[model samples]
Target chain A: MELFTPDSGLVIWMFISFAILFIILAVFAWPAIMKGIAERANFIDKGVEYAQEAKSQLDGAREEARGIIDEARRQQADILRDADKMKTRIVEEARVAAQTEASKVMDQAKESISQAQKEAEKNLRNEVSAFALEIAQKVVRNQLKDEKSQKELVETLMGDMK
Target chain B: MHQRLFRYMVVIMACMILPVFALRGEDLAGNSAAAHEEDKPIDVKEIIFEHLGDGYGWEVPFNHHKRIPLPVVVKGSDGKWHVFSSGKITDHQDYTEDGVTFRLAKEGEHKNKIVEVDALGNETRVTDMSVTKNVCAIFLTMVVIMGLCFWLKSWYKRNGYKVPRRGLGAFEALIEFVYNGVIKSTLKDKAEKFAPYLLTVFMFIFVLNIMGLMVVFPGGANVTGNIAVTLVLAIFTFCFTNFFGTKHYWKEIFWPDVPLWLKFPIPIMQLIEIFGMFTKPAALTVRLFANMMGGHMIVIVLTLLIFIFASFGPIVIGATSVVSVVFSVFMLLVDVLVSFIQAYVFTMLSTIFIALAQESGHEEKHEKKEDAGGGAKEAAAVTTL
Candidate 1:
């Protein structure tokens, strides 16, 4: 029972002592310690947030890298396609040029051949005419042996041609 | 490092041996002194009472004769203060003052009490307001708490909120526990504002309670076991809860949001609600005091069982002593756990009371709505003018 009953003096002392102790601790101790704790917590939060941001940035960069690779692939395919088209065009152009040159050569060869044939005919005609004149000269000389005979022969030849 | 460790072990061994030798010397001297008379039985109750209660001086066994004198202060009926060291009174057990004898009474209801006797032999009290052993313990506890708190404060200042690895890591867990578990769990968003008070109260009660469980100089104060001490803590909670209480809080006590019939019939509910406020603090007071004191008493009684059974014979006493020691050690372990738990419970409950005593609910929303309407109405009236 005495234990249960609190002495007033002790109560007063406790009251004042606790009040002072509480005030001192509340003002001095708690704020400083809590500040430290909050700062640490904030640091941790920032670290996590920074890590997440870096991860997202990495993802974005990876996507861009993929896009660049895809664009390079497309450009490569376009270059290959263009090379194929140009190669065929150059081959086609050479073939057409070669055919034109062959045709021109053939036309020149035909024209030269015709000209040579005409020349040959003209030469043959000239040779025959000369031979005919020679034969007439010999025959007239043997038959008449004079200007009279040549005239006569000329007249005879003209009468035979008429 | 190994050399340093060995040196430490040597120093510890020396300390242990020195204390044993001193105790043995004292026992030998006491035994020799007691050889002159029949050996008296040890009074277990008296030992327990002395340990549980405060004394004018700190007791030590120096040849088992006297105590170390502390200061004693008492106010005389002459309206003046008399200050004297305990050496003048405790050892001699006699001190004369102003025609009255101030001494320790060894009989009747005044046994172990300080009282004054007149020349005619009538005993009266002259206010035994001395800085007793318990007061010394209280101040020591205060010093320890202050030292730790201030030291940690400096540590934080130096380290800049870094998670303390070695310097103050011991306190970090308990501090974090109170803040996160008790303050955040109960006080919600208001935790930060009330954290300082709650943390301080928690540490004060915790250190004191843990010290109370110890059987040594710094340990055996039983400060938390004192009803007045618990009452002071409870009163702080009471003051904090009511002081910061909001309009909605008062409304819960004076005008609850119950049916009109319940509130208007006779204000019975409101009365009950008001009574609840005091009872909550009262419960806090009694719980801490009773738990600490009960633990101390049980441990003492268990230890006393050895002497109690010694009456049967040496063999009976020897067997009972083993059981007594085992049970006592078990209780002491339980006391340690209770000390921490009770401190935590008090802090958490106080935080809860703080939360409950704050402004929350539809009533606050209604108030805000009313304020907004009033502002608008005032603006319209001014415009009309």
Candidate 2:
């Protein structure tokens, strides 16, 4: 009945008890416990498979998005380049037309100026010649007025003229 | 028929020869003088030691009240001394063989002791000790069981079988049960590493405990009722706990930190905790040993009541026998439950102790984090107000 007695026989019995208990547990309870563990493992394995599938899908979507972005960028670059080329062509065409119109107007102005100058010059010459004939007739009339003296003067004038 | 006959003959011969061979080489020097004239024949239960007259020797005597083996010393035909006890023989022939000769005394006579002669041709009084038959039986049982387990395990492995069908299946199941219930419950991450020890401890205790039950039930054998067996097991646990215990565990036990106000009392608390550590395993040892021994004592006492009333009447004997049987059956059931529970408790406690020892630092870190979080929450509430 004493506690903590160093009874050697009890030691032997303890060993025996331990051995038998181990055997019983090993046989029956162990399998059930292992079944639980196996089920857990299967659950984890399924989770891992789902995660892998999700990862692969995400990667595929990312790749598709990247492809779309690249395509959009290429189209953008083409549109911008076309716009630049059209702007340059429009500006060059406008500059050429403006130059051509200005030159045509200048040529017309030069031709009209030359014609007007020639007419003005002819008129001036006729007017000056008439003026000069009138002056000369006036002088001749004055001199013939003195006709009486004119026969003699005419003779002198004809002589002087000769 | 010949083989059967040969086996019978062999058994008969063994029966005859075993006692004779066992009796041979026992030292009978001191007891022979006392046993010369006997009122009753002295039953020599055990022989402790033997020595030649030229040197010193000693022997201890015991009575055969219980069926356990008493330590025995013997000298073999090689003129050497040997000690037989605990199912093992330690040969001292290298030192004693040159100077001694040994022989068996008479068997039928009351003088069943070994006689040793020294180099001077003088008869020397030496002790004759022999290992007990029960001890030998227990030892043989252990070896056979272990061998069978190993063989089955190997065979299963070699055959590429998934699990054992019969005996091996039982063993694997027990292992897994301990692994999950005791090891996994007590140890979180490193259960597998500790599984073997836990399983071994559980199985060992359980088998022995059940053996104790068997001893009283039908084919009764008081194996676990013996103290020496329990002591060895306890010692094994003690050594294992100490050896595998983490440094942090020992530190916590010896130098635990307490609040500043309780600093003076910390030493006392630490002392108690240290004592607690020792007591845990000690409790394991005593709980198992007491339960087994208590059940056995009760059954024996109950059966003894029949003998006390033997002279009264047949009716009394019959009644007592019936009562004893009924009580013993009840006790057997209890013992069975105790066997499994004690094994589980021991393994679980040991695993928990190891786990605690190994992970105290982590627990402390977690606690500190919680405390800090609480403090931060309090500060945030104050600021919000």
Please give, for residues A98-130, the per-residue lDDT of candidate 1 as tens digits.
Answer: 989999999899889888988888888788778
Prediction 2 TM-score vs. true:
0.47
Error of 1 at B194 (Å): 3.0
> Each candidate's lDDT (Cα)?
0.77, 0.55
Model 2 C-alpha lDDT per residue in residues A1-162, reported as the tens digit of each score: 122343333344445644564455456443434554455457778879999999999999999999999999999999999999989988888888888888888888887887788788878878887888788778777777876866987789799988
- Reference-based TM-score of each model: 0.74, 0.47
Across all candidates, what is each one's fraction of true contacts kept?
0.59, 0.19
The CAPRI class of candidate 1 is: medium
- Which 10-residue span in candidate 1 chain A carries the lowest summed lDDT? A1-10
Model 2 lDDT per residue over B230-258, tens place: 56656666666667777766776666666
Q: What's the i-RMS for candidate 1 in angstroms? A: 1.6
Report the lDDT of model 2 for residue B307.
52
Which residues of candidate 1, in runs, are more than 4 Å off? A88-92, A99-162, B1-41, B59-66, B87-92, B257-267, B309-330, B364-385
What's chain A's TM-score in each predicted model? 0.65, 0.50
Could you say which candidate leads in DockQ? 1
C-alpha-based local distance difference test score of model 2: 0.55
Per-model DockQ: 0.51, 0.07
